[model samples]
Target: MKRFEDKRVLVTGGTRGVGAAIADAFAAEGAAVAVNGRSQQSVDRFLATRWGDFHGIPGAVGPRDACRAVVDAAVAALGGLDVLVANAGVFDELPFEQVTQEDFDRSMTVNLGGVFFCAQAALPALEESKGSIVATASDAGLISYAGAPAYSAAKGGVVSLVRSLAIGFAEVPVRVNCVCPGNVDTDMIREAGEASDDPAAYRAAAASRAPMRRMATPEEVAAAVLYLASDAAGFTTGVALPVDGGGVAGFD
Candidate 1:
């Protein structure tokens, strides 16, 4: 049978990019997936074109009520939640000194806070199902980025928080882990790179900085998450899997 056959999966911010890739991967594995995004219209459009028994739930994961609502919607649609991929986050490129309190709050709310709330609300069902949770962290959480301090710090919190959950829930049979991806060719990274004074040069420099000599694709990172969510990673928990192409090898 397929690995995720009959599994019910929910992927936040799955309207595009990495989240979308993950949602698709699970569905391809025979999962009943719920795709979440801030835009109901986008969610509708996505569901209309996608195969498998997929549901579209629209809401921002940052808000506490919204977080609970997404879980509820997923359970309502798929009967129960077996896996949750917390892929909703914001990324902005600005100097540390230029980052306002508003910027910091927004970053934390979506990146770190959303993960915490979603996992917390999903814990009971997860415990019942012995399910898995995968949070989307960034290589920035393991290293440092010059222009994205807030983003880095928020992602770092994600890694730490999920690790704690892993240990706390060890006996509960709910596995919690994280995926720290490097520069992926998503619109987020592309826009950040292009925001520099020399957009073209910035993209080239960023691309060359990685040891692999190029950024990763969303599909590549999604595969790692899928593995963790499936029985393939049954023994894995509380670990931050780096899809960075050795970007953090020298940093630590």
Candidate 2:
């Protein structure tokens, strides 16, 4: 159960949702976790009563300088970086043709560009520790989502970036992989529900679309990421693991 004992892990955007779950999981397993968020106040509020071994570094991952600063502080706090969960991302529903440049850029900046910057910043310490990197992508990255062009494209780019890192860092002893999730019941999902105007009905409709007739939990996705980042997945680099209540299994 303590597979991550003594490891130093970083979870970007760890203030909420899947990122918070990933940070909590690592801390539960004895890793020294750095919960990275955009605001110190928010991070402090999140850790107000949190248990286990963890620290906080407030920095937006989308900016290169901020990513480096956060990584540096995390490494200094934990003494090194053993694993990274690139879980910071944004989702929006926009028609492909109508998606504005701002929308596309925002998605790419926070999702794809943030992954690149944060992962790059963590690489040196990870290389030294011979650690692993797990990216949080989406099933939309694997399949087309009718009204999520920017989000889908950004996630797809994340998948590609993870693969490239896996191959590029093969000789560095650092593994890279991605977890593609589907309809996790997080606040983000709630926001989507509100956007649809009928929360319960929208949630039900989304759940029914999946074979399992239910959405996954953030913990489920975090568990998948932990597995991929653990020693148990030593040979699992470059894979896009789907933790989606079988939602992605039907993709052609």
Candidate 3:
């Protein structure tokens, strides 16, 4: 049998990139997945194809109210929840000097606050179902990334959040963990490259910077998320697993 057969899952930011891959992976493993995008239109588009039968829990997830709404909607649709993937986040790569208050807040709210509130909202369901949570953090949270100071701080909060939540939920059966990926080959990365004057050079430099000499695929990140959410990782909690192609290991 598939690992997640008959399980129920909710994936925030399920419209694209690593989020989409993680959603698809859960569905493929026989979970009744709930996909959450910022809007219904984006959710519909994501489910317009392979995820046609999956539930769409569309809503913006940053603050407490919105996260509660998404979790409530997903639980209502799925009857219960076996896993909650807090994968929704923003990537604003700005130098420390260039980052404005708005930019800093955006990263903190969406990247760190969303993960915190989403898990808080989902905790009861997870406890009842003896389920788990997998959040998408960043290797930037672990290592110093000079270009994205605010983003790094936000994700660093996530790394810490996972650890704290794991302990908080230990009285119950809920488990919490996070995956930290670096330089994923997703639209986010592509757009960052294309925004540069030399897109190819930008991509090349990103690839070369990783110790593995290539950016990780979304599917690779998805695999790490799935492992953490599955029963295979039942004993694991408060962990920050890096799926960063050795980027978190250290410089060459």
Candidate 1 TM-score to native: 0.97
Q: Better model by lDDT, 1 or 3? A: 3
lDDT tens digits, residue span 1-252, model 1:
888998999999998999999999999889999999988998998888887788999999987888999889888888998999999999987799999999999999999989999998888888889999999999989896888999999999999998999999988789999999988888887787677788788777777777887888999999999988989788899999999888988742
Error of 1 at 108 (Å): 0.2
- Ten-residue segment with the worst summed lDDT in candidate 3? 44-53
Clashing pairs in 2: none
TM-scores, one per candidate:
0.97, 0.96, 0.97
Query: Which RMSD does model 1 reach against the true structure?
Result: 1.4
What is the C-alpha lDDT profile of model 2 across 1-252, one tens digit per residue?
Answer: 589988999999899999999999888888999999889897998889697788989988887887889889999999999998999988898778888889988899999988999999999999999999999999989985888988998899999999999999988789999999988988888898899868899889777767888888899999999999998899889999988777878842
For candidate 3, the lDDT comes to 0.90
Candidate 3 lDDT tens digits, 34-92 = 99999999988887887334998899999899999999999999999999999998887
Question: Candidate 3, TM-score vs. the true structure?
Answer: 0.97
Ranking under TM-score, best-scoring first? 3, 1, 2
Would you give me the overall lDDT of model 1? 0.90
